[model samples]
Target: MRRTLDRLYDGALWLAAVTFALIAALVLVQILGRLADRAARAMDLPPPGITIPSLAEFGAFLFAGAVFLGLAGTLQAGGHVRVKLLVRALPEAPARWLGAVVSAAAAALAGFATWSSALQALDSLRFNSVSYGVVPIPLAIPQGVMTLGLALLAVALVDSAVTLARGGTPAYRASEARTEADTEASTGESA
Candidate 1:
């Protein structure tokens, strides 16, 4: 189960990366289309009419996918912003409790977002809603992707909270420890 969850998280992160790449590709195509049109017009020729339909809308949707899908991977990697100063100020026992509480709250919020997004997606699907743009896109598709990401993030937060409650280090803490160890090793080697 643990291995499966890890794989799922990894897959989500990979999907996010793919979405970002797609956004870049789409933007590039849009730029090239515009440049080609400009050159044709300059040459007193009929404009090639090259254009990426709904490029802005598509880019926006892809950007959102990248962000939402990356959340779980970022948390697991210890890349999410955290207030270390506050955590360090607390006693060890209190710190542990605080960490668990924060994780729980995050899980709750993520779960709510997941549920709401899923419902919205379902509603969109039921209504057969389509985005208004040069290229009509079914709204439910992107919403479903966002919901999946939120669900993955909620699972990660709950796992962290449970690990803390059991007096075990969370994935993010372990990740941080590994990073610090690597940094120290590199510094020692340099010295």
Candidate 2:
């Protein structure tokens, strides 16, 4: 079951990357069309009537979408950066315990936060709340994507904690520091 979960997480991360690429293409088209139409108006070469998306606003929105979705993959792949100053200083035994505690707490907190925010965003969408836009997009969509990443991060965190508590982290040897990145495609034995 855990192996299946891991595969699912990896697949979702790949999906997120694809989603980001798609958004990028959409934004590119939107921006180019708007700019072209506006340019024609400025040159007085065509009818001075053109109303398209506000490139700046759309750009921000598109960027947010891409980032949130992309984050899921990154987080799942364990590409998120972590500070290891204290962990590195300690010897193996103590460091292992400390790492487990930290990982568990971090996972629980991040997961809870994301879950809560996703619910709230969903409610907002249901109620048709509009923030600074003529057309309101359902906030839940992107928020949900961000929540997915957070959930994956939570899973990774918990897995790390379990392994650390057992004796050592799976991807990390006793002496060296393994950046969370390597865990994305873990090749070692499971804890």
**Candidates' TM-scores?**
0.90, 0.70
Name the 10 consecutive residues with the lowest summed lDDT in model 2.
172-181
For 52-168, candidate 2 gives per-residue lDDT tens digits of 445455456556655654553465444667688998899989988988888789888978877897887788778876556555556666666667666666776777788788885
Instruction: Name model 2 segments beyond 4 Å from true.
Output: 38-62, 70-72, 75-78, 168-191
Backbone clash pairs for candidate 1 read none
Worst 10 residues of 1 by lDDT: 1-10
The models' CA-based lDDT, in order, is 0.92, 0.66
| Residues 1-191, model 1: lDDT tens digits | 77987898899999999999999999888888889899999999988887889888899889888899999989999999888888889998889889999999999999999999999999999999989998999999899889988999999999899989889899899999999999999999999
Best by lDDT: 1
Question: Any idea what lDDT model 1 has?
Answer: 0.92
Please report the TM-score between candidate 2 and the true structure.
Answer: 0.70
Stretches off by above 4 angstroms in model 1 are: 181-191
